[model samples]
Target: MEKEEYLDLYYQMVLIRRVEEAAAQLYQQGKIGGFLHLYIGQEAVSTGLISARQPQDRVITAYRDHGVAINCGIPAKKVMAELLGKTTGVSKGKGGSMHMADVSKNFWGGHAIVGAHLPLAAGLALGDQYLENDAITICMFGDGATNIGYFHEALNLSKVWNLPVLWVCENNRYGMGTAVERASAVSEIRQKAEGYCIPNDCVDGMDVLKVRQAAEEAIRFVRQNNSPFFLEIETYRFRGHSMGDPERYRKPEEVKKWEENDPIGIYRNHLIAKQIASEEELDLLDEKATKETAEAVQFAETSPEPPPEALFEHVYADVS
Candidate 1:
């Protein structure tokens, strides 16, 4: 990637971090409600993988999805508005934090249920293949989702039919307060694909370049073979599973250890060390992202709420 590309990636990561921070604050202030999941430490994974996708490709994921939506080209103002439950939000405020979607951007809805979107992603890939389109479906989920029945079922059918999809497991070590060891028989998520015969690999989710490289390779494999692929991105989440989480599952020291690998900070240093950008330039980018996040909050604050009568509009499709 060129210096300009690196800078853009840095800008996006910074913007996402700021936006998630702001969302957490808003949730505390009662400005946003209903399951505020912050993507504080997982910014690089979303930015890298989403940046690797074509415009025609479709993306889906479980909750903890604000970064995914933003990286997939949803505007900060709209995403924040969605979190704030304003009519101007990406889903017109009906979806809130866990259900934001922008079909025009090809971001399929963010699923609140664990591992439920796996089959949906397969359906999308099947549709794409049926239509003879070259578009692939990227389904992202957390490590917790791996143990679920849908996870295995989707992978099985994806292999059986040779669907074009990428199953990305963002393994953040814990699945809603329970450690991976306590929940799964096999802790290595990529190894779960062995029975299904899907090509699989693991990537460092904290490093944007590594994540992008791995994503590109998986994407290429899917495109070339028109088959499914799986990637387990080993990462950590700085925040709790949700806003009100007691967080008794992990120690502060463990979090601190992972914080040392802070993705944005590490990438910023890389840029400066390689002469891709100056510290001053990076500082300016941070300032810009902060300003944009503030503006998004203001927009969400000023935007109108959805009308009660509008509730039924998207509830059902007209079969006629």
Candidate 2:
């Protein structure tokens, strides 16, 4: 990647991180509500993968979705307002934190149900293939969802039907406090794909370049073969599973150990070592991101709440 490309990727990651941090603060302050899941440490996975997609391509994921929406070009203020249940929200205040969708950009949603989105993504791929549009559907999920039967079913069908989709598992060690080791028969998530004859690989989710490279290769393979592929991105989440948990499931040292591989820090060092950017330039980017987040909060704060009468709209179709 060129220096400019690296800088853009860094900027996107910073934007996601800052937007999520601001969302956490809003939830704490009672401005945002209803099952808030912060994507503090998993920004690289979404940012890198989404960067490789075309505008017409679609993205669907599990509940930890703020980063995906932001990376896919949803305005920060709109997302914040959606979380706050305000009229100006992305889903018009109906979807909250887990159901952000911007169809104009082909960002399907932030589905909350564990593995429900997988089949929906497969259907999306089918649509693309039927229409002969070379677009791909990127389905992302957590390690916890890997154990669910829907994932396997979706993969098998997509592979057999030669659907253009990439099943990306963000293996963040724990699935709402239950570690993958405790939840699954075998801890190696990618290896599970061999049974279905789907091509599979693992990538370091924390490293943006690695994630990008892996996604690019998978996307290319899917385009060439018009088949499904599987990727397990081993990542970590720094914050508690949600706003409610005390997070007593893991030891502090474990969290610290993962922090040692902080994606942001690693990428920053790589840029500097490669002479792509200097510390000062990165700091400026941080400052800019902080400011942008602050502005989004202000916008959400001032935005009007949805009108009570609007509740009847966008529901059942009008029958004349």
Candidate 3:
């Protein structure tokens, strides 16, 4: 890849890491309420794949969505504001952390239900297909969502109709507190797509370049053939399922092992090895991300809270 592309990927990954870290701090300090899911270790998955999407392509995902929205071009301040339930948020502070939606950016939403967004993703693809548009839809979900019935139904429907969609499974090995072995009959999540006749591949989720390559191929396949494709990225979450999770299911050694393969560190080393960037340059990039994240926090803190009367505004739609 070109130098600028490498720099862009690295920068975005750093931005996401900083943003999540800031969010965690804010949540602990009681500045942000709600069940916060931190995307600390899964940075490469969203950064690489979402960055590969076209302008008209739409993205939908389960509750772990701040990273996806950021990668889709939603301002970091707006995401932070939404997390803080500020009126300036993307969802007008209504969606909070688990329900950020930027229709203008084509980021459909961060659906709170386990596997519910899968069908909505298919519907988006179907609409594009019916309109004869070349745009595609990318649906991202965790391994836990795969076990849900909607996952299978959506994939089957997409396959039958030949809708342009990409199903991306961020297999982080545990669903809530249950390990994949304990939860899934077949631990290899990519194999599930075979039942729906969708071509699928598994990539090292810790590697940004690898994820980007797989994303490019998946996007190409869906767009060219007007069909669905699946990608199961083997990654791990450094944090618990949620902020208060006791995390008794996995050992500390396992977490340590994965931390050694940390995506940001790996990519930083790759850039240095390729002579594309220096350690100093990368550090500067990290500083930039940190600065930006602090600014986002400031923006969120000062943003106004939604009024009580405003609650009924978006609750219902005007059919007329």
Q: By lDDT, is 1 or 3 better?
A: 1
Encode model 3's per-residue lDDT on 29-63: one tens digit a residue: 99889899988899999999987899999999999
Q: Give stretches of model 1 more than 4 Å off.
A: none
Poorly placed runs, candidate 2 (over 4 Å): 317-319
Which candidate number has the best lDDT? Answer: 1
Q: State the lDDT of candidate 1 residue by residue for 1-320, as single tens digits.
A: 88888998999999999999999889889998879888999999989998999999999999888999999999999999999899999999889999999999999979999999999999999999999999999999999999999999999999999999999999999999999999999999898998899989999999999999999999999988999999999899999999988889999999999999999999998998989899999999999999999999999999999999888777778755
Q: How accurate is candidate 1 locally (lDDT)?
A: 0.94
lDDT of 2 by residue, 95-187 (tens): 999999989879999999999999999999999999999899999999898889998899889978999999999999999999899999889
Q: Rank the candidates by lDDT, best first.
A: 1, 3, 2
